[model samples]
Target chain A: MLDAKGLMVFYENMLALNNVNILCKENQIVGVFGANSAGKSTLMYTLSGIMEDIKKKEEMAGGERITVSGKIQYKGIDITKLRPSERARRGLILCPERRRIFKESSVLENLRIGGYLASPAQANKTLDYVFKLFPALVKLKKRVGGFLSGGEQQMLAIGRALMAQPKLLLLDEPLLGLSPLMQAILIRATKVIRDEQQISILVTEQYARPVLPIVDHAFILENGAAVMEGSRDELLNNPDVRGAYFGV
Target chain B: MEILIYGTINSIALALMALGFALVYGISRIPNFAHGAIYVVAGFITWTFLKVVGLGYFLSALIAILVTGILGALIYRFMLIRVRGMAISEIIASYAIGLAILEGLRWGGFKGMTYTLPVFIAGSVTLGGVPVDIHRLLLIGIGVAVIALLWLFTHYTRIGLALRGMAQDERAALMLGIDSDRMALLATAFGSMLAGLAAIVLLPLGNIVVEAGYNVLILAIAVCIVGGLGSWMGAVLAAFLIGFAQILTVVYLGSHYQMVVALLAIIFTLIMRPSGLFGRQKELEERV
Candidate 1:
């Protein structure tokens, strides 16, 4: 469903993403495993066209000189130069790192805001699906987003993205700062969403063990480079992968 | 009794004047320094349509509001779009636009005390033994109605919800397909119309002079600064505070001190709390 080739992102003199390639087939969950500063978020930003926005903002502020070179194709259409909002309209939604929820809005309002591109019926249906997928949110419908726990916030973030009716959902570090139990729940839900909605997902994580069981294809990123690529079992069987990511 | 009635009316008027500035700032982080120019221009447009063009009052007012909205959209599209994300540039460009518009109108001969709008109703009623004009009473009603309508619009409508989302977090809203540029344009247009509304409602009580533009700008800035830059509720509360203070000054220290009250409120708020009363920026700073 999505293909990105030869993606290179530079921040001044430092390279954030170096000659990397990633793909997500229809109805597939692709895992990107990397440590801190591994270019995972940069990859997500590049794919979702947020890099263009960041580049423009940085340029306007006269801050960093960010350079991004890449070709991104979604559903066989080149979308490298599309704005983030345009990409989102075409169903490329990113649930960004840190669960950037509208802190002042209530959970229900957050979901409503997420339904910006959706029709009334589509929004209502997706909203119902989101609440069903994250049933815990049903109880906290009126609670403000900032007051929610980290786990609840992550759930809300995913639910909010689902409200956008994404064809390809990019989950950037969904497991960060989450409890093991919450991570397990989120991983399981991620798989169920793919099965139920037929939506492709690209999830990035530092630890791959909890997510490995669900991802069909996995890539390991090291220092902005794609070091390894294989199917789930192919990665799980490797001693180095198991030792470094699986903590075995 | 006179003080109470006049204070309430004056407070509502101040709230109306500042609402547009506060809203544009809140949604797009654009200060919209052209707010006062829009107000004066809308009043002039309505007067032109009414007297020179011989149109009816309602039609002229409606046309003026629409024209002002388009003017605002044009300002954003042509001028403000490039300087966006740069705070100083946004302010300077908008203020420059405001200065040009006000000065242009003055040069174009939209001066003197002869330009005055007719009140919607021409009667006075006794309120607590004080004679209050129907227009002032109508202004209060319109002010309350505008606030209520704005609340309902933001809370219930799809576009309004998207706007609120953008106001809270621009990038997150973008991730959900809410176009920030479109929302900002809509905000600028709506805010200009709000300024127009204030002009149409309040100008009937006095003449439409070019100098009123500068006074309106200063007053709007003072109220917005005192109320916390982007909070509507804060603007309303601060308006009442400063409104009452201005009324009391006019009653005791002479009417000339009315403008002084607004300037003093701005200064005091800046000195006491730079963030104003309900500022979220300060909380975010504290968190960091």
Candidate 2:
């Protein structure tokens, strides 16, 4: 389980995220729905500890001052100050926005790199699971990641994140720019991964319809603020939520 | 026939000099300007081990390589880590380290041409009616072996894959639990070892003088600039291109013009293909 409370992020005078709270219980799928510039990616970065890295880089370059204040509890540990790599070592893996897969590496190589923290035996086992979860990747093993189609790249990205053996997976816009069919396949696979692997997932997206079926609890983020939070059924009954997120 | 044999040998030597520079830059994007200084230091360490400690040549070389590796790691940990992500600072910091090491050695009485490493094997062999020393032949063998071993290491091992991933995308690698600092430190250490290896193999041909460090640094930079900065294959190919060009210049234009070939190659590559032969900038632009 992971709990993030009172998270606020400021990029100079601009507020990227404002006093937002999000949580995910063990083996649960939590959906965060937001539109453009809704701080979805910022939230993901904050939770995954990548914001700390960004802040450091910005400080080194004397660029925009990034100020982050939050308290993140991951499985009972205070992890707000942890570096991304350290967080990753504790199984807090982030499949970042835009599918950020290693473009120059082959699909297998990407997966192997993802297995950096795993023991040899664990890596082997997870590699098998990843291949099984994304069967389309098996044939594209040797193909370069940059050359892959958007759907294939997203699959590889998720597969790569899985190779890291995540206890809590944070997926940022996994369905972006994908066809409806591909989205369906990925959403189905996401559920299957949760059920089989018993991994908690915190997935963020602009469009929530395709992902609505799987997520048990969901939050609606509007302009860096969490506007609503409820169970899937509770959210579905709200006409405003349906109209804004599901376009129903 | 002479040109062909000598050209290949020259190319291999150039590759040996540039591989470490390319590797550290490739993985960590840190242009270790101290590469050449590390080479000279390795040579001196080997000399000390063999002459002062009365150790065997092999043992001395091995310990020297290890010490230089640690030296490289220390450089990264203590200095490069602070200036990281700032390109100008990174270059200045590393170059300063190089200058200090080279000048420090000179000040410490490590100058002059009397210091030399013994050749692994003696005598010369005739090939195609052209005579070549056994050591040069052995250098070629070691060069090829190093290349093959590096290829296998990067392609097959877990750490190698992680390093490649780090080279391609640091944030993505971090998401997968590969620590950037640790990887950078490893790269600097391994790169230093490669530099030391090159020194151990090549120093037998000449004296280990501090001035050689400056020449090696320039040559290494020329190769990296001509090749693409971070591409391993590009560095190797550029080494051959520059190497053969250097040898050809030496044969046709006189030996003194050899350095001119490398300098000219660097200028030409910058003018015609700023990204070098296999630079990633073009690909990145295309992707964008």
Candidate 3:
């Protein structure tokens, strides 16, 4: 239900995202696999409209000139120039890399803050859903966000995004810096969220093995370009993809 | 007994004055240098309503606080929005606004001891052989209530929680659909209303003169700086520290040396700690 075409982003003379096109259908989980500096995070930032804010700040400070050109259609509406908050209001929320949870705030307060735009009934319902999805968070409701472990913080970040009631959740490197077991648990929860809540997910990761099981379609990005796109089986069957990404 | 009674009263007053400045800085990272100007303007507005418009004290005070809040929001929306990210520009612009307001009021003949708000209560009562006015007791009561109410607001309310999130990590808050500009505007408004509230309660003890505006601004800055820039608890504790110190100076040395106490506290804090009593930035720096 989301289509982005001909998306190009440049920081001065350097291209950060080069004519990238990505899509996610309704009730689908899409995976983007890449190495460091592969423009995966850049692509996610471009989609979520945070690039607009960074561009404004850079221009105001007379720093690097950021040029972005794209046509993003979500549910048949073009939202290329929308502000980040406006994009979020349309149910496109980003759970950013590094899990930028509010450190001083308690877990419950972080979730409550995420429900800023939700009605009381909706927030309450989603809060219950989030707690259920991440049972580890139930016991740490009163704990400060900074004190939580990296795995717990990732769960809280995803749960906080869910509190916003996203139709399409953009997860940028959710598995970064987490143990293998934590990655497995998050992958399982991601599939569960898609299955039970009918929310579309676009998740990016450096390693594909843990995340590939849940993704219906996958895209391989290299040097700011999308090199390949296919169903999970198509990607898995490719010997080159197996050697480079899947480690099969 | 006299020193103890007056010191508590003085400390609470300092806390009330610094609370608004601390709040705006804490939430939005805007120093809001116009806080003192807003305090004076609220006093003038209350005076106009009470005397010229013939409104009662409570009604006038309420309306004045509301007007100052809207004034603060408009300032952020129209003026400060242009210079949002630059720290130096924010300070210069807000201080310029404060200068214009304070000087503008002076130019408009709002001078002298003519403007004074009537105390909420009249006369005095003896406490342990030290007589304190009823109005000062009411000030202490209101100050405690304001702090309690503020604590509850930040902990339990929706917008308040969002503000706390914004204060901690603004980009993360924005990603969660909490509008940053809207939250900053709300913070400015709430902070200005707090300054107005402080003025309504504190200005009644003496004439509302233009000089008090500058003095209040300096004192607020001193409290914020000495307490650590954006820490709420730091500001309160610093206020008590400075307030008691000021009272002690007035008692032992001389009343004229009272302002020196606040200035000296600021200098000592900067030299000894640099981050004040509880600066989070210093901790972050140390970690890095």
- Model 1 per-residue lDDT tens digits across residues B11-128: 9999989988988998999999999999999999999999999999999999999999999999999999899899999999999999999999999988888899999999999988
Better of 1 and 3 by lDDT: 1
Candidate 3 TM-score to native:
0.98
Output the TM-score of candidate 2: 0.99
Clashing pairs in 1: none
Question: Worst lDDT window (10 residues) for model 2 chain A?
Answer: A100-109
Q: Report the lDDT of model 2 for residue B207.
A: 98
lDDT of 3 by residue, B85-151 (tens): 8889999999999999999999999999899999999999999999999999999999989989988
Candidate 2 residue pairs in backbone clash: none
Report model 1's interface C-alpha RMSD after superposition on the true interface residues: 2.0
Among the numbered candidates, top DockQ falls to: 2
Mark the regions of model 3 whose C-alpha exceeds 4 Å error after superposition: B281-288
Kindly list the per-residue Cα lDDT of model 1 for residues A13-81, writing each as its tens digit. 899999999989999999999999999999999999888888999999998999999899999999998
**lDDT of the candidates, in the order given:** 0.93, 0.93, 0.92
Candidate 2: Cα lDDT at A201: 98
Interface RMSD of each: 2.0, 1.6, 2.2
The true-versus-predicted C-alpha distance at residue B207 of model 3, in Å, is 0.9
- Tens-digit lDDT track for model 2 on A39-110? 999999999988888888899899999999989999999998888999999999999999888888789988
